[model samples]
Target: MTRCRLCGSTALESVVDLGATPPCESFLAAERLDAPEPTYPLHLRVCTDCWLAQIPPLITPEETFSEYAYFSSYSSSWVEHARVFVEDAAARLGLGEDSFVVEVASNDGYLLRHVVDRGVRCLGVEPSVNVGAAAREAGVPTLTAFLSPETGAAVRAEHGPADLVVANNVYAHIPDVIGFTKGLRALVADDGWVSVEVQHLLTLIEENQYDTIYHEHFQYYTVASAIRALASGGLTLVDVELLPTHGGSLRLWARPEEAAGEPGRRVADVLAREKAAGLQELSGYTEFSARVAKVRRDLLRFLVDAAEEGRTVVGYGAPGKGNTLLNHCGIRPDLLPYTVDRNPYKHGRYTPGTRIPVLPPERIAADRPDYVLVLPWNLRAELVEQLAYVHEWGGRLVFPIPELSIVEVER
Candidate 1:
């Protein structure tokens, strides 16, 4: 049995098993489709001791992120989210030209550009050469190395301890959660703050967001477990904000343990809500696996019905979560003949396990498929609006997560 990654507890209980899946981000080129793809067991386990939901790191960060495919700037909604975060964080931190800011896992300078535009000095630490080079090309100062205690110390030495440290959506991707948190401790100034955002585990279970579970994300965190994990690295959680991004995420605010601080009302409120939702106990997770199983059945039934009725279905957005959902449900090009993505890198590539060909979004209009399956259901609103022209042909959008539903488009 794999011990809990966060707390190292022996009492790890299975929450949900996604079975064997390939690295979600490994989009295959036409030539590589015949090559044998490696797959790893994707199972979520919760530690009874600490209630930290985690998955073993079957794949290394180098294999997953070094030459990454997903670019944050591809999604305009995500870029806007980053821009808004930078604006709000800068004002809240009282940032200035002298204030040094560092963003860990800064993907393609999507957020840091806003920081630099405001005259705040910032550095981005990105492990992926592809995205890091893009960040550099975009004029955001970037280091092509994973953030660790060693790298964080080097960053502090050369750039000075950061007045503000931002880590968005990378907290769960880290295998060494404690080491990453310690690096955050090393990177931030004494009076400064570290803001980390992760998809909230509570939301994952409630919304049947098992699609987010892949080899890349090593752990899922709730308020209680996140506070515990952060404390292990000499940081203290002082505040938290529930964000609507990435399904649902928690923006955690922390300072060094020496700082005298009390948990804010928001923190207490969320904790209370988590506790009320039974996040503190093992029994709360008992029904999760069954719920996740239902999603697979629901989605497959919908797709099979569409095919039987001679309806053509295509997909939008080739995200990692979409790949997971597709692979787990045993979907292939037969049900979803092809998909579309805006990222040029993924345009010619096929989805990891399902081998569904990905094309450009313009093809959707040209082909005019009867139903467009919105794979990235979290961004359903944005996708619906972006592909609203499909409604002109009496086509509607379909969502496959939480529950399978057909989106009603206003004609």
Candidate 2:
């Protein structure tokens, strides 16, 4: 934390300190609820030299991803998103039966299944034993191991060089940014491509998406910083695409330095936008802490008002970001009572720090709560359609991020 993870500099400045909280994915079993739960300081800092926003590496990936709770196939929209990405990537890259595709941190084979359907040889490198088993059961070849330079080279040696390496939503998960990037470089063919999708720091600050910050997410990236990080691993950013997923994200297309030519105009355009937003300097981050504080205050006020007025408020989706929001706002079961998710892995378990009960999706309809707080706001469109049935019982949906707003769903 004292030195930049990407750049070896000691000019890191405070971004926001979210206080102490347990690992966001550490759901408590009924029996383990009595045991002591550990928490770590959730502070974010940006290196002035490289502008890479990061948190301390307090916890290891082995502790969290060894047996992950999240299953990407649980959400129909995310599955469809993966399917579309696979189809487009195959067409764009002219991938065929001869092309070999590999996805790092591939959870439950959600994306690789599409690659398999296309008759393309593919493999999933996942760290989680349980979810990796699920992927293998679904007919996707998966290797249960973490992604390191050694792991990457081993995969290439055994399976041969991959034509396309897809790493979605995992660029920020590792603490060793340079090492992870080098692993990515080693996985793909010398002339092949690597596509990485990560949440953009631009939207995280502008949209008040502070809940995405957690112990597992070691660093956040802007296109400017991302360019530097990619080069550290001997990969060059050739193209960039702005995506709507995860509130906002960047899909960076890269390749081995020798094969990478001039970066596309989109890369320059996005970097221009980041600069215009003042992310490269101190001006962009100066107001983020204050904005985050206001969000916490506003959400707490609404929850308190609802309780006093005798309105029943429950939560939807037991996502990791929800844990950050709950713990940061100091919300307890009394305020939230219970939350529901489609992922049965979390049912009957309690949120790590808030200790809110996670139930099945049917519980919301059966209980008929007056309001359902939507936790995974990034999936707003998908959840809105799924929860439209709440209108049958006069239940409205609540979103707490990007400012608190209540929406009435139509049947």
lDDT (Cα, tens digit) per residue for candidate 1, span 1-411:
468777788999899999999999999999999999999999989998999998888899999999999899988999999888988987887888889999999989999999989988999999999999999999999999998889999999998999889999899999999999999999998888999999999899999999999999999999999999999888999999999888999999999888838989999999998998888998789999999999999989989998999999999989999989999999999999999999999988999989999999899999888999998898877887898899889898989878888986764
Q: Once superposed on the true structure, which residue ranges of model 1 sit more than 4 Å away at CA?
A: none
lDDT of candidate 2 over 228-288, digit per residue (tens): 9999999999999999999999999999999999999999899999999999999889999
The ten-residue window of minimal lDDT in model 2 covers 1-10
Number of the top lDDT candidate: 2
Could you tell me which residue pairs clash in candidate 2?
none
